[model samples]
Target: SHFIVGLTGGIGSGKTTVANLFAEQGIDLIDADIVAREVVEPGSEGLAAIVEHFGEHVLQSDGQLDRSALRECIFSQPKQRLWLNECLHPLIRKRMLELIKQSTSAYAVLVVPLLFENGLDSLVDRTLVVDISPELQIKRTQDRDGVDKGQIENIIRSQMPRQQRLDKTDDIIDNQGEIQEIEQTVFALHKQYLSLSKAVLS
Candidate 1:
């Protein structure tokens, strides 16, 4: 089996920043969000199935999946959400596994925003949760995405409770500090994961 470390955080938790710092240390990143998008790109089976079930309105004029439209569709219909997940999760997981297999780093970082929600921890040897304050999460998400506070709060509500996520994580990276400090912590974790990977691989 491959040595995999899962990095997870809620929206606006700066997971990308922390992941980049590890990438700088030669770690490969298998980002679930990116894989999710890739699986639904134009002409993919995933997209075709989506269109078949949801109709063409889920796609933009250029034929790409209209993320906002799909989101709205699922948001208004819980059954649609479950159906879409059933349609897409297997494709996403298959692609993610392919990416992980291609990774040649000491250990790959499987960065997922819904690591716990999607039960992705089973794919990794260890899990890292990036923790941040709710107030900061709202502010950062609003600044980065131009999303309103109510929408951001809704996203937060949709995720596992902060404490529950923490209880399940093997490692916790605090994103409440300065970027310099966070980078330093990432470097430290990189070293730790490298050693841990060695132990596991040996």
Candidate 2:
């Protein structure tokens, strides 16, 4: 397997943007969020299991998962949230690993937003945390999603604390600056990862 870097960040910390920059350098990306969605698409067993447990109301008229409705239900009910995670986490992990094995790049980025919290760090050779101030995270999330500040705060509280996430990471990208700055940081990491991957192979 290629060397794996687990990339994570708090909500609205521009993780996807950073991932895109790495992708531009020809690194493969196995994104947990994307695989999470895939596991629950219309004909998938994941969606079928959800409908079985949470009922068909979790589905839209087109038979797709009603993500907003499911999100609201889970957030308001702790038991429901637990049950949903129990159902989805294994499926997500399975798919993520399968994709990672298919990568042919010098190194691959495994983008898991809950990398630390979910114990996904074990899957990677190194960890990268994209960091921003808490205030910036709150503002960016609210502005991007049009959600209430309270909701954004709650989501942040649910993840690993900011400093702890940084402390555990093998690399950190400070994402509070301009787009050009972030790009330059990612470019440097790309080269570093290439070297690290070769070292691992040797």
Candidate 3:
């Protein structure tokens, strides 16, 4: 198997940008959010199970899962969130490993937002934490998502804290800067990762 690197960040921490940098370097990136959505597509077994458990109220008029409705329900209720995770995480993990197995790059980057909270870090050989201050996280999230202060705080609080992520990481990329700086850092990291992978393989 290729060396697996798990990349994680708090909400609005520019994880997508970092992942894009890895992609540009020809690294295979398995994005959990994208995979999660795919697994729950209409008529899929995941959707069927979700509807069965959550009732049809979680669906929109077009018969697709209403993500907002589901988010609202889960965010307000920890048990509901846990139930949803129990239902979806395993399926997502199965599909993610399949994708990882198929990757043709020197290594793979698994971009999972909840990597720590869900213990998905065990799947990867190394963990890269994208660090940003909580103040910036809240501000960026508010500006980007139009969420109120309370909602942003709730979302931030719901995840593992920034310091905890830093504590658990094998590597840290501090991304609290301009886009160019972020790009430069990611570029450097990619080269380092490639070198590390080569050394391991040899």
All-Cα superposition RMSD per candidate: 1.6, 1.8, 2.1
Off by over 4 Å in 3: 68-80
lDDT of 3 by residue, 1-202 (tens): 4789999999988888889889988899999999999999998889998898878999999989999888887886989988988999889999999999999899999999999998999999889988889899988888898879888888899899888999999988888888788787777878888888888899
Q: Tens digit of lDDT per residue, candidate 1, span 1-202?
A: 2789999988899889989998898889998988998999998999999999989999999999999999988987989999999999889889989999999988999999999899878888999999999999998899988978999999999998899999999999999988888887888888898899889977
Model 2 Cα lDDT, one tens digit per residue, 18-98: 999999998898889789899999999899999998888999999999998888778879899999999988898888888
Question: Candidate 3, TM-score vs. the true structure?
Answer: 0.89
In model 1, the clashing pairs are: none
Pairs that collide, model 2 = none
TM-score per candidate:
0.94, 0.91, 0.89
Highest TM-score against the true fold, candidate? 1
Q: lDDT winner between 1 and 3, please give it.
A: 1
Compared with the true structure, model 1 gives a TM-score of: 0.94
RMSD in angstroms, candidate 2? 1.8
